[model samples]
Target: MNDSDRNPIEDTRFGEITVRQDGQNGLEVEGEGIPRVTLERDPESEVDRQIAIGTRDPDRLTMRIDGLEVGLKPAKGGLTRRSYRVDVEYRGADYRLVPDSVPGSRLTRDGVHIGDFSCDGDEIVLAEWKEGADIRPEDASIGYALASAFGTGGQPMWMLLIDAVGLATP
Candidate 1:
């Protein structure tokens, strides 16, 4: 869908942000203080999955955001759990995009909850955000990456059902 066709996300810090699919494996996000962000999933990642942000080196699985080279990795939650983790690399900086069992994910810095996002239909809504927290373009970019890569829309109904069952089990 075109940017005009997609619903814009109203964020507290960035204002109205638009997200759209660039192609089969890429997503584009636009907003204030946020450069037009693009994330592309590597196709030959049957074993080692990776995402390339903007013009980052695909082989390195790392991207430069605001002068910091960040590494993105998807770790399996477990054999049964469908959740995954995205880790950003920096000295003493612990950034993670932790998925909620439902539709979206929580952005945590050093294990502190700072932002919450949810998927409603085709739109991603920022449910909650901590005031005065250091908001950066990379933060929103990571959220879009997670939603595009691991959101419920990409899963089959049967897999979703299994995930629901798994959540209910423990």
Candidate 2:
């Protein structure tokens, strides 16, 4: 998948995005006319340090991230097909980000169920106004346990956008 035209590295851009493919895995995006960009998708961040009763606790968390699914349709004479699904649980709520089904409602990547979108010349706005039901664990301490259990975390939005743009561009 590495193109020779990309001498030292393979890179492509659309608008303000410059992407470099990561073999068959995914893409790395950068600003077109700027330095590298790091997208911070962690709502609570990797670590929150403060005095917990004049002390401190090392904060940790993990996200249940799934891999991409791709295949070929049998009935369509070997036509290629792809689907993207991302599941994230934060603050006792489940956030699922998948492709907009042809007959489905709207949702954003940040786990907003009911929302509105507006467009201008070169900008898009997305919002979820509905206060959906809250999801909680059986035991309140389970969240904390799981949070500290995983040393690393998953970046769902980063995965979705990188996969979508990478697969589509090249």
Candidate 3:
């Protein structure tokens, strides 16, 4: 098969934001008035992922902005295959992308609710943004990446109980 025929294009959009996955490498996020962003899995680190702002890849957890090294630290989740959330430290701020009741996730900064991430069919949507939220493109990109990599909602309580029961039996 040809390269184009091998990779199926999946494009999703809500408002000005758009996310496209080519069924191969990773997804690219684009929106109005913001730079395009791309996220790809890290082959070296099983638990780590990489993001490229525009077309640059500096490192797994670091992205250069305006000639300054912007550190992106993985506090928890998203870095692992089984994680249900992503707690990140970026630009001296703590941002959390957590699963929500909407079968999606909520984004918060320093414990303050900022926005929600949801999916419409194959399209990932930035559902809601609270008041006074700057809602940077980078943050939205990361949030979507977290949801795509890990998942939106976590496992049910019954699943956990079943795992516990299995452990007790053995």
Candidate with best lDDT: 1
Better of 2 and 3 by TM-score: 3
User: What is the C-alpha lDDT profile of model 3 across 1-170, one tens digit per residue?
Assistant: 01222232232222355556543244555555335555543444334223212112224433233234344443343433234455655567777776666366778878888787665323344456676876765566556554544445544556667877999995
Worst-scoring 10-residue span by lDDT in model 2: 72-81
- Our model 2 lands, by Cα RMSD against the true structure, at 19.2
For every model shown, the clashing-pair count is: 0, 0, 0
Q: Which stretches of candidate 1 lie over 4 Å from their true place?
A: 1-4, 44-69, 77-83, 90-92, 120-127, 152-170
Sort the predicted structures by lDDT, highest score first.
Answer: 1, 3, 2
> Which lDDT tens digits does candidate 1 get at residues 122-159?
34545467777776665676665555544422344467
User: For residues 51-156, what per-residue lDDT tens digits would candidate 2 score against the true structure?
Assistant: 1111111122122211212111111111111122223343444433333432122323245453221211011122223355332221111111111221112234
TM-score of each: 0.62, 0.23, 0.57
Cα lDDT over the full model 3: 0.50
Stronger candidate by lDDT (2 vs 3) = 3
Candidate 2, 38: how far from true, in Å? 8.3
